[model samples]
Target: MARLTKKQKEALAKIEKGKLYSVDEASALIKDVTNTKFDSSVDIAVRLGVDPRKANQMVRGVVSLPHGTGKDMKVLALVTPDKEAEAKEAGADYVGLDEYLDKIKSGWTDVDVIITMPSVMGKLGPLGRVLGPRGLMPNPKTGTVTMDVAKAVTEVKAGKIDFKVDKTGIVHAAIGKASFSADKIAGNANELLTTLIKLKPTTAKGVYVKSIFMSSTMSPSIAVDPKIG
Candidate 1:
């Protein structure tokens, strides 16, 4: 195993061994442990007591952070001619149909969130090979694929994010930035946790939220007590 750096060792020292902290405590501690020069993203990893492989047990949903994600989300609005103005007015970074589609076909996925209409989804089906793997594909469930292009684009710009449980039953998401106040970080984390609780599948038995960890881009994770939510 690689030896820990001086900074890494120092970071670990700040966290008590085997101690599970409350949401507020973990949020503040994460900022204290972050050693990155740039503003690092504060992420939350939630381990759920469910099997993702089972269709009925899958957990996926969207949440709008109360304090908003610190980073500006680059949104692409792929819409027909009539809806272009609406999309642009809603603060979409990029707006268009054929040209954007051609760019996507050419392996140009430079944007974060892609919001498009149901009619446009048919054209996007062929480009799934490029978008699917990157998790940029617009899905109806996430409200990314909808006729209300303006609403979708606005929501995404206003800190809306979608997350799905991984194969290992962990849902990982960047809740905010380390530069944000501890209260802001904790607020975002709580919002996400509450949403996840509401989305628990009926088939999921026992402890829905098994564990939660909060950390920055390169900081040691702080264990968050699941019961605190």
Candidate 2:
């Protein structure tokens, strides 16, 4: 195993071993432990007691963070000419149809979120191999595929984000950046946790949220008390 650097060792020392921190405490501690030159993203990892393999127990939904995610989301609005003006007005970084489709066909998915209309979804179906693995495929459930292209683009530009449980039953999402105030980080984390609690599947038994951890891009994970909202 690679030896830990002096800074890494010092960061790990700050965390109390076997101690579960509250949401606010963990958020603050994460910033303190982050030593990266760049503004590292603050992420939350939630372990749920549900089997993602079972459709009924799958947990997936969207939540708008009170304080916007520190990163500027690059949104691609794939709409017809009629909706081009509306998409541009909604702050979409890229707005077009066939040209953008051709770009996507030629292995060019450089945007963060792709928002398209229901009518255009048929054409996108064939490009699933390229978009699916990258988590860029527009899905109706995530509001990425909708007739209201403007609304979808605006929401994504805001702090709206979609997250789903992985096969291991862990839901991981970037809440904000380390540069944000502790309060902002805690608020975003609380909003996501509240949403996850509300989305608990009826088929899921026992503890819905098994464990919660908060950390920065390169910092050691801080154990958060799951009971704390």
Candidate 3:
């Protein structure tokens, strides 16, 4: 309820500039400051000033979070006939035959998250053209297209936030609300950071992490000079 005084603001800026926060520390700090169940690591990544929209900065590879991301992501599973039950048990909103090719043509625009096996991707070229623009295309490079249906759906539903690199190579994503505990964001951030560090492409030149920042939906960006670069 109180604003950060000059001294407090200065200290925060200093710590932020250092940009080293563990999951526990971030969660504890946020917990003491606010009461909200929105545990999003995206917020922490944003606090570090990591943009989520850059194509160069993207969510690729297998990033298994210790705690699933907290969100109600509508899931659509595309699988063969036999896998219908498996998809349903995974809690996918919609499970279907491999003919999802026609399905996406008819209702792809409305879906939030999509999971598909290699069998499905065979017919995905045109679909990619359609969904890529909408940011809904399932690219294996981004770990969206996988043979594991349940795992994909579970991660997506659990807030497995994906970061993508745009023309500028920067990405943007949501971690949680401003009221969320810093610890949640920190954990999410740690998971994300670890993934990125591990997946730095061979083509990527010097310093994968550029700069990071965090901010609430209504707050200003808290620039984080993590010195990872």
lDDT of 3 at 108: 54
Q: Model 3 — which ten-residue stretch has the worst lDDT?
A: 43-52
What are the TM-scores, per candidate, against the unseen true structure? 0.98, 0.98, 0.69
Please provide the root mean square deviation of candidate 2 (C-alpha atoms, Å): 0.9
**lDDT agreement with native, every candidate:** 0.94, 0.94, 0.60
Please tell me which model should have the higher lDDT, number 1 or number 3.
Answer: 1
Q: What tens digits encode model 2's per-residue C-alpha lDDT throughout 26-138?
A: 98999899999999999999999999999999999999999989889999999999999999999999999899989999999899999999999999999999998998999
> Per-prediction RMSD in angstroms?
0.9, 0.9, 5.8
TM-score of 3: 0.69
TM-score order of candidates, top first: 2, 1, 3
